[model samples]
Target chain A: MNLQLLAFMILSLVTLGAAFKVITARFITHAALYLALSFVGVAGLFLLLNADFLAAVQLLVYVGAITTMLIFAVMLSQVEEIRQGAAEEGFWRRILSARFGVIPLAVAAALAGVILYLYRFANWKAVPVAPDPNTTRSIGQAMFTTYLIPFEVASLVLLVAMIGAIVLTMKKEDRSR
Target chain B: MIPLFYVLVVSTLLFALGVYGALLSTNAIRILMSIEMILNAVNLNLVGFGRYITPSDPRGQIFAIFVMTVAAAEAAVGLAIILVIARRYGAAAIDRVRMLKG
Candidate 1:
């Protein structure tokens, strides 16, 4: 196998494994950490796909900002659960007692199977060529020129999110009503 | 060069995992995390297609950027809502927070 394929295999394995742990980990804090690892793996995949700008953004936004936010939220909200430990019922017992034992897994598997089967019929026009090495410059140029309106809209969305979060989480006494 | 098929497969698996997590988890935060994974899977597919199919145009990458931006915003607002629920209800589990039930 070539080096690129080898790297892709390893990266996908780590990504998928960590993603699984995010769902199954007993400790929610550990699950958040696993989620971060999965994000990093996706970033590596982005690099492999020659999306260097996206890879960096993935690391910065996902690993740096989003992970921190999640961890903080967990700590803020789950203080009691964290202190006492997530010592819930055994995994198998919980699964058995849930609404359906394996319905979720079966549904997910079915969806993936159908998508993959459909993929076989659709012939994609794939071109094997070297992509532009300087994706960051290209992305920046596009942001200002072709994607300026969308860019501004994204900024507006971020601003709205920030203000909404502050308003939602503010102390009731702090309300000026 | 890696085939686009493998990348698509990986993305599909990740999406499936996300779907399962979203379905099985009672914790609202975990559900939100699963949503993030789903978005990440979509981003991977976009980047993979961009690299192999349309290397000249950066639309796929741009779309991925937009996805990330929206995801970040979603995370912030979702967490804020979760915090409100947790503070009011003393837990963030979906089963526990049923006040909005119609």
Candidate 2:
């Protein structure tokens, strides 16, 4: 196999494995760390797909911001009781129980299978083409010109989200005053 | 150049895993994390198609950026809401928060 294929294989394995760990990790903090690792792997995959600017954004937004926020949430929240419950239940028993039973796995597997099966019939029209090297520049130009309205709307959404989060999480006394 | 088929396969599996996590996990934070994973899978598909099919137009990348922006906003709001639930109820698990259920 060529180097590109090899890289893809490694990155996918890392991404999938870390994602699985994020779901299964006993500690919520550990799960957050695993999520960060998974995000980094996705960033590498973005590089492989020639999304240079997106890879940077993935690393900065996902790995740097989101993961840290998740860890903080985990730390701030009282999740220890659930962790103890999982540990007492035992790993296999917890996963095999009716609450976390085979249904979810079956559903997920069926979804993947159906999508892949559908791919065989659909004409994707995917041609092998090398993407622009300076994707950052082109992406920037489009963001300001062709996608200017949507771009500003996204920023507005962010502002609203930030304010909403602050309002929702504010102390009772602060809110009243 | 890597084939788009393989990229699709990877993204499909990722999305499936995210679905499983979102469905199985009782923790509200875990569900949020699963949602992020789902968005990431979609972003991967967008960028992969952009690279393989429409290399000239950067629309896919631009769309992906918007997705990322919304994801960031979602994370912030979701986590804050979880924080409030946790503080009030002392647990962040979805099943535990049943105040809305009559």
Candidate 3:
């Protein structure tokens, strides 16, 4: 295996391990911390893919802003420490487990089927090389020019999300009192 | 020759794990984290395709960036909603906030 494959393997393991911890860990704060680690591993994977700008943004926005917000929310809610037996009491836990188990098997089967289908149509005569001089500038140019409409739509979505978050989080006053 | 098939396999496994985690986890925050993992799995596929097939255009990288941005926005809003739910219901378990369940 070459250096690229090695790096990919390492980063993939890191991401997958942390992701497991994020869900399996009982404590909310521990899950959030593990999620941050998973995001950092993803940033490393992005760097390996030569998306430097995106890697940086992943670290800054996800590991920094989002995880901090989650931690704060956990702390403020005083639910950082989960009480024992709480998980066992919920009937939804069993339902959720069954639902989750089936979906992963389905996803794995579908992905395998697609890969096999693509392999049947594979033409080995034409193999593409990796692009050289990968930079954020080229990406920005493409986004602004070819993908301008989608870019604008994404901005609109973000705007709407911001407004919705504010509306949802805002406290209602006791007008009747 | 390390076939690109392995990359796809790994990505698929990651995605499956993400889906399982997202669906099973009761805590709102863990669900959000699992969603992020799913998004990362998609990002891996995009970058892998970009590396092996489409070399001229950085479209996949651009799309991955867009994915990251959307993920960030989603985390922000989702966490805020969870906070609100916790405040109202005194807990962040998904089953407790079943007001929308018909």
Clashing pairs in 2: none
Inter-residue clash pairs, candidate 1: none
**Candidate 3, residue B71: how far the Cα is off, in Å:** 1.8
Clashes of 2: 0
Model 3, docking class: medium
Instruction: For each candidate, give its TM-score against the true structure.
Output: 0.94, 0.94, 0.81
Predicted candidate 2 versus true structure: per-residue lDDT over A1-177, tens digit per residue = 399999999999999999998778776677788989999999999999888889999999999999998887676656575333233334456579875768888899999999999866778785657535688888999889989999999999999999999998898999777
TM-score of 2: 0.94
C-alpha lDDT values of all predictions? 0.88, 0.85, 0.73
Task: Rank by TM-score, highest first.
Answer: 1, 2, 3
Poorest 10 consecutive residues of model 2 chain A by lDDT? A82-91
* Candidates sorted by DockQ, best first: 1, 2, 3
- lDDT tens digits, residue span A80-104, model 1: 6532224544445666764644888
Which structure among the candidates has the greatest lDDT?
1
Enumerate the candidates' DockQ scores in order: 0.72, 0.69, 0.51
TM-score, model 3 to reference? 0.81
Scored by lDDT, model 2 comes in at 0.85
Over 4 Å off, model 2: A82-91, A128-131
Ranking by lDDT: 1, 2, 3
lDDT of 3 by residue, A103-149 (tens): 65576567656865675577644355654655678888899999999
How many residue pairs clash in model 3? Answer: 0
Against the true structure, whose DockQ is highest? 1
